[model samples]
Target: MRSLADLNKQGVVSFGEVIVDYISNNKDNTSFKQFIGGATVNVAVRLARKGISSTYLTKLGDDEDGVFVKEELVNEAVNMNECSMTTTKKVCKVYVHQNENGDRIFHSYQNPTPNEWLLDSEINSHIFIDTKVTYFGSGTLFHEKSRRTTETILELAENFHQIIAFDTNIRLKRWESAELCKKTIAAFISRAHIVKMAEDELLFLTNTNSVKEGLAVAVKWAIPYLFVTRGKEGAIALHNQQYISTEGLNVTVVDSTGAGDAFMAAVIETFHDKGLPQSKTDLEELLTYANGVGAKAVTKMGAL
Candidate 1:
């Protein structure tokens, strides 16, 4: 069997929701700042920017917001032929509220929204089959319809023998209960070959405070590699019974909004374009590239 590095070097196919972020920096702001965002969509765009051929699969509405998001992806040269449109709801919007500590509190509106209620017919099986890597985040698994759609995509990806990469992008407020979020995310975790999780996510998914104990639980699912992200402390990967650590690039903190997404994008692009994960040298090189990308993302306000 070919390794994940070989598969990623071939290219990638990503599936998830693409949302228009309606953000505000002022308390009584007359209008909000809009940015094209969504975890998988950002990954696809960044991959394209890095000269990787990327296919983005998802549903968007025919509304103005949706048009803007699609146009942004098109402008970035992402392959969006697998994307669909529904005229029912406007695009998904995320309203951001900041606390005194500068931590963002998101108020999202999504319930049977056009994108969330995607039909399986909207996606093309051939696209999934042709891609070397199929990536997605757990955010889209909250709703029943979209959850089912995500599951179907995973099944098709397995059939196509694609390398399945999952990001444990747990959003507590999106689900009805923390228990439910853990359960659903575990289902996807069991299916992924490569998993990217944060330090806090280790505690949430495993109910443990230690990364080692958390990794023990994650390894039980037979995931080949696990990357644990430690903000500013850098990232560590547990693979082949060795710990590969990389230090973060020192940079001014403007907004930490899309740093992780940027890092994920860099890793995926490196794997797809350069057949990485072959050696520790390759891992270190990619980590260095990702650190640069992540640091660059914070200089901007939102995901592009």
Candidate 2:
């Protein structure tokens, strides 16, 4: 059986924001639920839940919220060798709104946290030397120190036989301009071995509403694998000169907060299970499994 520990032993390191997700239920008077989140963090949790030994690299304030976040990571069994508490900024929080259609919108509160906090530590490549895969989120690329840190890490790992995955988890409100977001995200996509873009996200990034056109653009940039997730309709994946589509599972939706992250976790798990460099048929299976996991995630209130 493929185990999370096996993947970890081989090497998997996730670099991104680790935030406290403050979620509110649209039903039952909009009660709140707090969960440890952020895109890569959510994927790391799911990987750990499946027995993968994963390490999360991010910063959190040395406060109650930070305590909660750390406790959650420990409970999930994610490697925290590089995680640290920052005295400079409080932990970031994302407040989410789940509409009746199960779509989620979010407002973020940031602390001007710098990526130097992580680089200044003992994060030698040897610690993640075994890591065969490195995952990063686009949000971190918005800040210079953090973006440079992520870029440097990827540069360092380039010599290693590793697949670099980038999730274009765009937050336009966090950037200074739309042009900057597009430029930075496009640059990352051009280099990523695997890239995931939502239907709406492609429209925003490419300024093109057509999926075919957007994917064509992605292909022109030389991205090896491109996944376009269309909410409700399902997701389409392109790999190795073939296109495969997976229909979304039918389920009662509550909050769609973590669905995409869940989908990502499932993709990684399936890829790890099948071993490196999957065929088109293998890609289809992975996308189907990921969609199921994503559908199930929306049935709950939080990212967990």
Candidate 3:
């Protein structure tokens, strides 16, 4: 198996929803900011920033937000040629409310929208031919039409024997029910070689509060590697049968919006660089680096 570094950065691609995150200011109801978002594309952009080339595949509307997001992707050096389009644009409305003590609350609006209309025509075997990985965003896995398209993309990726990665970027509102989400995630788990999950997502996937119990699910599914994210507590992972955990760094968080996306992006890059860790020390270093990436993301406003 060739690592991402081995492919010289040409073989990594991110596939799924690509939309705009409209961040509204709660203090001033009239003001807002727009950031290019969508978990899978964020990974592609992050990889590009880190000097890796990656293709972003998704559908955008021929509208203002879509144009803005496309321009942002261009600035990020992510390939736009592989992306498709729709007639209506889709966006996530994120309201950031704050209390006197400076604590913040986020209310988000993300559902079946234009981005979910990604078509099968937008993909083919050639996308994975030179790619070492075809990473999918879980946000696109709930919709029937988009999920079918995603499954088709994965089929092509698998046919090429590319590394298939999945992130349980599980936002409950994206699915019909929690039960359905779990079923969908499990199906993805069975298909992917790498899985990136938040601790809460791990609990849901494992159906138990205990990390040990959750790990058992990974073993049951024959998942080779599982990365568990723990916000400020850092992260833990089970590689093959070895367990590795890394400590968190002290950083003042600005907006923790896309921290998980950044962390997963690093995980993909690191996995690309060396395939997988050969020793406990190597694994720990990777976790430490991933933690730093997540920390850095919080210091920024959006996912990218």
Candidate lDDT values, in order: 0.76, 0.74, 0.77
Summarize candidate 3's per-residue lDDT along 1-304 as a digit string, tens digits. 2123333334587887765666555555456677767778788888988887788887787788777778888888888887786776464444544445444445555554634577776685576777788898777788887888888888877776777788988877667899999998888787887889988888887888787788776666667778999888989888777778887788887777778889999988987877767788888888899889998988866666
Error (Å) of candidate 2 at residue 179 is 0.6
lDDT of 2 by residue, 206-300 (tens): 77769877766655666677777887789988876567888877888777887888888887776655565446667777788888888889887
Instruction: Write the residue-wise lDDT of candidate 1 on 1-304 in tens digits.
Output: 2233335336688888877676667545345787778778888888888777888887777888777778889889898777887787566667766656665556565545543556676767878656778899987788887888888888888877778888887778788899999999988887877788888898789888887787777666666667777778788777766677788778776667667888888777766666538888877787777777877887767866
Error of 2 at 149 (Å): 0.5
In terms of lDDT, the poorest run of 10 residues in model 3 is 1-10
Tell me, by lDDT, which candidate is best. 3
TM-score of 3: 0.89
What ordering of candidates by lDDT runs from best to worst?
3, 1, 2
TM-score of each: 0.90, 0.90, 0.89
Question: RMSD of model 1, in Å?
Answer: 2.6
Give stretches of model 2 more than 4 Å off.
1-9, 27-31, 100-102, 112-117, 120-122
lDDT of 2: 0.74
Clashes of each: 2, 5, 1
